[model samples]
Target chain A: MVKLRARCLLLGDAAVGKSALCHMFHSDGTLFQKNYSMTTGVGLLMKCVNVPETNDSVELYIIDSAGKETLVEACEKMWGQPSLLCLVFDLTSEQSFASCSHWMERVHAHCEGLHVPGVLVGNKSDLSARREVQGSVAQEWAESQGLEYHETSAKEMENCDAPLLGLARAFHSLYQERRETIQNLSPG
Target chain B: MIDSSLTSLGAKVVVATSSDENHPPENIIDGNTTTFWMSTGMFPQEFIICFAEPTMISAVTVDSFNVKHLKIEKNTSQNASNFAFVGEKELEHTDGHIQTNAVSLNGSSATHLRFIITSGYDHFVSVHRVSVQN
Candidate 1:
């Protein structure tokens, strides 16, 4: 059985459903709209996900960080630990989408030298009518960055598992390539 | 809802109350913040400050008292200063009795306006009272 550890950082403006997504993805499958106080500091949770393809059981450390000046510092603290980063943005607001640029820059600065897989998530996809961003615009941005994009409705569990599953596959592919490169270098 | 008061220093002070304390939001560090956004009104174009600090000096305060204040401009982010202090002289007069400090903004003009509390404590610097001086 393969065991992997990954940390997913949720970066976005205040009230962008970062915490809500964390709750939804966890094993509980519960929904909370109780208006959790804005995360002043980092809020963390851990869940073990079982991948059937590789028979791998991976533990995901999810960080729902507060959107404040401390964000830069926190990102630096968890810089090397994250294997996958999700830059979450709200669908209803254009400014929230714009703010994702800052988050991307901060993540890039901290993850220096390492190419971590990233996904751009347009949250609140359930609210299509109120959505200020077009999927194609987000897709174009993601394409330029060479990152995958997904519009998810954590509220309804739509496209929620796609990124996590995709990340697992990407990790497996990288591992296979590394194994092949190591074999090629072996004397045998 | 606009105030008619006009002061020489700052425009009419704008203050609003929290909708409900029953639901205060938490931040990253577990620090709590209550949101209070006052509607625009007839106020001088200056920094409208808001603060939240303990009401006492006690044994904790040494160099400065914890005074959370902010300078807000129209259609812009508020510049916040946390864990600040009023001048020693101001604290000396108020004697930590800040509950009666009147929480007032200057009525006339100025470059840098400071709030000085001598003594006593109020435990909160809410956006309650607002006025302007001529």
Candidate 2:
């Protein structure tokens, strides 16, 4: 059994339901709240995900951070070196979706050249009537950025675990690739 | 390729140069990168990993932050002393991220593997995880 841990960064524009998504996933859909005061700093939550058909498990240390630009800069120091990224956006708001690139840029600048396994989360999926970003568009954009796509609704507690689970799986597989390289060392 | 890490095989970190309440040397073998063993604040920090039994290793991958130079030594003896130099590497510096590097061990059998950090990119360095391949 291989137990790996990854620091997962929860990022996006302000009021993108990042906190709600994090809480829903962390509490396993039992902690959804009607009101959440603005998050000013980084909130940490950890969850262990077991990969199917393997004894390997990954511990995801989710850093749910403030989405405002001002708060984001202050929280950056506390984020440490995030190995996984969960970029969130409000599906009903096109402006929030547009800011995904900016958030990705911040991560790139902070982590330098390290490859962060990531997923683009389109939250608030239940509000289909007011949706501003199409699924196909977001999927295409995520693919271009080397990130997987996930749609979720924290209010309804729908598909909230997909993004984090995807990240955990991705991190586990990344370690697997590295293990293969090490195992294929040819006794040199 | 091996599917599981040495953690499942019952490896332990027996000795370390420095230890903090939040960051202990044991974190190095936990197979979790988010939890790490951090150096208090200086150079020449080292640690010894003791395996459940003498195992043959071909390479080791280290995930660390701010570590500049590293030397790996191994020994098959019951004690931690009298370790032979297996290999050394100079790691690249990464900003706000762990520097992952895999070092070839040349298929040495050992009960204990000692990693000595001679220098660092910053004042304090942290070793997140170390995975060995046999």
Candidate 2 residue lDDT tens string, A1-188: 55666678999988889899888987988777789778899899888888777776777888999998888889988877667899999999999999999989889885646677899999999999999999999999999999999999999999887887788788877766543333232211
lDDT of 1 by residue, A1-188 (tens): 44455556777887787877777777455564556676667778776666656665556667777766555575457444455676788889899888988887877775534566767888999998898999999899877765688888877777777666655555545444532332233111
TM-score of each: 0.53, 0.65
- Candidate 1's DockQ is 0.01
- Categorize the docking of model 2: incorrect
Show model 1 residue runs off by greater than 4 Å: A69-75, A78-80, A186-188, B1-134
Best by lDDT: 2
Q: Positional deviation of A77 in candidate 2, in angstroms?
A: 1.3
Model 2, residue A54: C-alpha shift (Å): 1.5
Q: What DockQ does each prediction reach against the true complex?
A: 0.01, 0.07
Query: Which window of 10 residues has the lowest lDDT sum in candidate 1 chain B?
Result: B24-33
